[model samples]
Target chain A: MTDIIVGILAFLGTIFVFLAAVGMVRMPDTYLRISVTTKAATLGIGLLLIAGAIYSNELAITAKILAIILFLLLTAPVSAHLIGRTSYFSGVKLWKNSVMDDMEGKYDTSSEELRSGFETDPEKSKPTKSSG
Target chain B: MVDRIIALDLIITTGIGFISAYSILYDQPALLDVAMILALIAFLGTVAFTYYIQQKNKQ
Candidate 1:
């Protein structure tokens, strides 16, 4: 019974990990790619870990697994958000097919205050203004 | 979209953890050792990567 269960888990974990790799490499945008790779990979290794924990029944190992799970749960989304937001501000264009930037239009362009203040520093603008 | 996927991953990981604990309590010492290592590695990867992800965001 135990062997059967372990075999099944190992098989599933391998498959999921494979998909994660494929998705990471093949996805169109960095944001989408990271999202897929992280979530899928997280699940795959998590299963593998659980398999190990069950086989050993060590309390320390179980505790470690719990910690990992907690950390992943807390952080993956924030990472993806930061990366996506940074990439956007850095001028990596979103996919043309992207329909809605929910964060969009909320940025009222007419407001100079919307600009990151450091970007328009007197010294830097002086050069561009002088050139013009 | 990613939120749903992450939620799903959390569920599966938790379930797998329970299953692993069950296996450990049983007689599969080999499986138990493997599970423990896998658990450690997974936790470490998530924690490390979470930091990596967060740092990437900060930059």
Candidate 2:
């Protein structure tokens, strides 16, 4: 019974990991690719680790598996975020059909700064300032 | 740019995990140790890459 469960989990994990790789290849832009790969890979690896722990049934092995899973969970998203931010800053263009770019006018590529909406329009703030 | 690198890292880590699990299934204890070391290497590689990206972006 335990063997059957472990095999099933491992199989599913491999499938998910494969899907993530396919997504990475098919995605149009770096941002979309990162988003797809990160989510799928994290879940796949988590499942795989769980399977390992279940199959081993040994305290030390299970503990190590849990530690790896915890490390992966905590770091995966953060690394993805950092990579995405760096890519955006580095001017990796978005997909052509991408409809809404929240960072469209807010981010300055040259300076690597993100400006508030109010800061982008001088006219909006002119009225509030009094000439001395 | 860095997104691709990170994605590649993730794929490699997943492969390592699979290999580790395969070792356990085969009753090869030494291979399990290798898997643990690989996992640690992967984690450290990610951290280093993140730091490199930050440094590159700042300049």
Candidate 3:
């Protein structure tokens, strides 16, 4: 029974990993590709780790597997965020068909800073400057 | 973009780690140490790469 279960988990994990690879290749742009692969590949490996723990059924091995999973879950999203931020700042163009871009006009390329998009009232600005 | 690439690299590393761990399970249990080391390397590699990219962008 354990063998069968392990085999099933391993198979599913391989399939998800394969799909992630395909998504990486097929996605239109860097951001889309990153989004797809990050989620899929992480899940794939997580499943594989679970399978490994079950197969071994030993305390040490299971503990190690859990640690790996924890590390992965913590780091994957952070790395993805940093990568996306870097790419955006570095001027990677969005897909032509992208529906919305909140960052548009808000990012200052020269300073590499994101600007607030909210409209500032001229009266408030004048009053603040005069008071100061 | 760099993040995605980093993630892809990590995913590949993880797959390799899985393979190594399976070998340890079936073949030489002594190779368990190899799997552990690989996990450490993968974690450190991601951190180092992210730092490199950030530093490069700052300049």
iRMS of each prediction in angstroms?
8.0, 2.2, 2.9
- What lDDT tens digits, residue by residue, belong to model 3 across residues A2-31? 988988887887777888778877888878
Candidate of highest lDDT: 2
User: Model 3 - which docking category?
Assistant: acceptable
lDDT of 1 by residue, A1-132 (tens): 766776677668767777876775577765676577667866776666566655555797677666655655565565556545544433345566777654442232223113333455664332121100
Across B1-59, the per-residue lDDT of candidate 1 in tens digits comes to 33333334344444555555455446444444444444445445444544554455446
True interface contacts reproduced, per candidate: 0.12, 0.42, 0.20
TM-score: the better of candidates 2 and 3: 2
What docking class should model 1 receive? incorrect
Q: Candidate 3 clashing pairs?
A: A83-B3
lDDT-based ranking, best first?
A: 2, 3, 1
Q: Residue A5 of model 1: what lDDT?
A: 76
Best-fitting candidate, scored by DockQ = 2
Which regions in candidate 3 have their CA more than 4 angstroms from the true location? A119-132, B1-4, B7-11, B17-21, B24-36
Return the clash pairs for model 2, or none.
Answer: none
DockQ, Cα level, model 2: 0.51
DockQ of candidate model 1? 0.12
